[model samples]
Target: MRFATYEHRDQHHVAVVDEDGTLRPLSGVHSLTGLLTEAGSVPELLDAATRMLDAQPGPHVSEVRLLPPLQPPTVRDFVTFEEHVEGVRRSVDGAAGVPERWYAAPTFYFTNPYAMHGPHDDIPMPPGSSVLDFELEVAAVVGRAGRDLTPRQARDHIVGYTVFNDWTARDLQSAEMRVGLGPCKGKDTATTLGPYLVTADELEKYRDKDGFLRLGLTASVNGEVVGEDLLSNMSWTFEEMVAYASRGTVVRPGDVLGSGTCGNGGCLAELWGVRGRQDPAPLKPGDTVTLSVEGIGSVSNTVVPGADPVPVPIARRRTRERP
Candidate 1:
């Protein structure tokens, strides 16, 4: 079953999207958050959902305003693709290889969850960024909560997946890394999520012999295809990423964890490594970006001006002795 939070009648509602692309509200349920908090609720939620579907569809998907499927309690994006890691390292470390530590275990960073946008939303180019880019990736949503779980055990915790576009401000990211911190201003500006969230059961057919789902990745800007990849190329698995996240802390429902950039030219940074940064220009206002995965739906966003102009940098002056 596909799920989403959409706006109708000036209020947001949690809805189940049927196979026919019709949406019907889950009776008595206010948000996906509530259904996810406890076990055995999905079946009940489905029964209620089915009842609504049994009747005529309440709304066609196009009529309602779609919102991010869930308000994630936390968002951790992991760099698990060796190709992406190697590409980024070449630009920053002057080496094109994954760090030994990364092979030992998956590593990730926490990003702002509140600033995320939904499908078809307008994303502002960060005020300080002239090199805005998009990271094409996929994300797994935590269905159940646990800590210190093994890879096999962690697998059960994931309930579903979604296409994730980690919008970036490359200029700000490059500068902050020099000081050994951030991705703050670089990424927190916005993240594009949804079309809708697909449940794990719906994706069982896509799983390979090794239990990883095989899916194609595609992204285009202003109707031009920019990047492409497959989800199966990651060296690390979502179970591993989830287990690593739960090593010392609890993983909760609604916590979103991403697969980072795919091996294909998933972003301008990686593309620059392969093709150089000459022809495929950086994003600007009015440019539209659409990202999609095989089974999961596609999400598109248009670039727009920042909410406010970039804040000016503070000026400094030297003082003489002890004035």
Candidate 2:
């Protein structure tokens, strides 16, 4: 069953999408936090939610504002895709150099939750961004709290799936990484999630005979298709990412784990050269980017540069020897 957090009138509430395409309020059935605060219970809740949706009558789809399904306590994104890492590494090899360990370990970063937006909202391009790009990703909502979880135990902790667009500022990212610091300013601008959350059981039917999740992902800029990739190409599985993330730390319910950018999937480096004669067509003031992942829905937003002008800070590089 499909579920969503929606705003009707003036209040925000949870709803379940029914077979007849009607939305039924789940707020009366269960508390939003109670539905998402534990593991292995989402399936039962979804079943109950579906039954509740089948019984109630509600407004048409065009009248509701869809919000991000879960208010995750912590938003963690992982770089488990080798293709994206390699693409960035190759682009900066001549000037900035690449790290050896980056290819071996699964790396991740914590993003600011305050910057997240829903599916149909307008994404404001940061004050000094001339090279804005998009990352198409599939994110998992954690349902259980745990530490040091094994790969076998990781799958059980997932509640559902949602499409994510990790909007990025390429110029800022490059400059910031030169200091050996993580992607702070480069990636902190905005992250878009939503349309709806599909429960794990609803997605299970789409799993291929080969035991891999089969989902088609596509990205478009101003009605032009720019990148396309499959979810099956991921080098590190979601279970592995979850296992790694849970090591020595507590991962709570409603926490999100992003599957990084899909290979040659959605970023500018994957679509065009990172640095070359042909510069990527960075998003302009009026460009609209739409990301669609099969099973889950599509999210489209228009880009507008920030109104006020701000100075671009000069970056200081670290001279430490490479390991």
Candidate 3:
């Protein structure tokens, strides 16, 4: 079953997607976080949703505006695609290859959950940034709480999947990383999620013997396809990323784990790596970016100009004398 949150009569409503693609309103439920976290488990939530479906019909998905399925408690994005890492290093930083430590384990960074946008929402260009870009990836929504979980255990905690767009400011990211710290200001702008949260069982048919999801992922800019790849190409599985996330910490329901960017031109930075320059150019006002994942659906956002940055006073070096 696919789940979604939509605005109806100015109030948020949670709905389940029917086979025909219509939404079945789970009356009284306002958000996916409440529904997902309140339930004892995924099976119990499904049972409740099934009962709701038996009650009455709801609105068609096309009619109601969709929002981010849930307001995640935490959003951790991992760099699990080797090809993406390689391309980014070569193009953005003019480096040759992936870092040796990158192969040791999956690494992730936390982004602002408050900054999330829904599918079809307009994305504002981050302040003081000119090189806006989009990343095509998948995200898993944790349905159960757990601590110190193993990879196998992590699988059961994931209730569903969704498409995630990690919006980025290339120039700002470059400058920040130079200080050896963050992608903070560069990435905290906007992260798009939605269309639907597809239940894990719905994707079993697409899973391969190797445990990889063989779904297709694509990103298009202003109606032209810019990037494409298979979800199966990921170096680290979602289970692995989740397991790593739960190490010595707790992962709660509604927490999101992103699969990072896919390979083969997943983002504009990768295209610049192959072309030696920004061939397609950076995203500007009026451009739209659409990222789609097979079985999960798509999330699209249009670029809009943002306010100019408010200048900050520069710090000055001081010399100590006869202290």
Candidate 4:
């Protein structure tokens, strides 16, 4: 079943989407957090939602304002696609390949949980950097809490999926990562999520014979197609990333984990690997970026001018070698 948080009667409400595209709102639940906090299975949540539905008249999705499904309790974005990692290393430092340790385990970094936007919001082009880009990816929302989970055990913890746009400031990222840290100021700007949240069972048909979700991932800018890839190409599945994230630490119901960027499916990789490192012309004011994943719906955002410019602090290279 699909779910959304929409505005109605001057208040936000959590609702389930009907087959014909109307909403069946839960009477008392006001946010996605309230719904996920219960840790109930999909069917149980649906049953309860159905009861609430009968108490209120439904509204069409077009009549309401949708918000990010949930303000993530925490967010961990994983760099799991080998080709994406290799391409980035090549672009940023002219490295030919991924590190050996990268293959040893699924690795991830924590990003701003509060830097979120809805499907159709217009985000200000992050200040400071002129080089801006988009990363098309899938985000899995954790439903059940666990610690030290294995891939086998983590599978059931994922409750739903959504389209994720890891909007980036490429110039800042390139400089920061060289100091052995960051994607921070580069990525801290904005991350767009949602058109709607699709529960795991809703995507069962997209599952391959091997039980992997083989959704097609694509992104376009200003109605022009830029990158296209498949979720099937990810080397580290979302489950592996989820489990790895739980290594000795607890993962709660509202946490979010991203599948990183797809192969040649981000502007950085596309510019370097496919476009010969030429300027593909990063996103600018008035440009629209739309991202779609097969099972989950699509999310689109527009870039506009920022009020202030953010300065990039590029660290100077040390001459020869300094201790």
Which candidate ranks first by lDDT, i.e. highest? 3
The better candidate by TM-score, 2 or 3, is: 3
lDDT digits (tens) for residues 229-278 of candidate 2: 88877767777788889999988877888998887646775544445522
lDDT of 1 by residue, 19-123 (tens): 787887776667676677754234544555566443445687899889999888899998888888877666544566677888887888999999889998899
Tell me the TM-score of each prediction against the true structure.
0.91, 0.87, 0.96, 0.91
Ranking by lDDT: 3, 1, 4, 2
RMSD of 1: 2.9
Each candidate structure's count of clashing pairs:
0, 0, 0, 2
Candidate 2 ranges beyond 4 A from true positions: 29-34, 38-40, 47-55, 92-100, 208-211, 274-280, 307-323
What is the TM-score of candidate 2? 0.87
Candidates arranged by TM-score, highest first: 3, 1, 4, 2
Please give the lDDT score at residue 123 for candidate 4. 84
Which runs in model 3 stand beyond 4 Å of their true positions? 319-323
Instruction: Give model 4's TM-score versus the native structure.
Output: 0.91
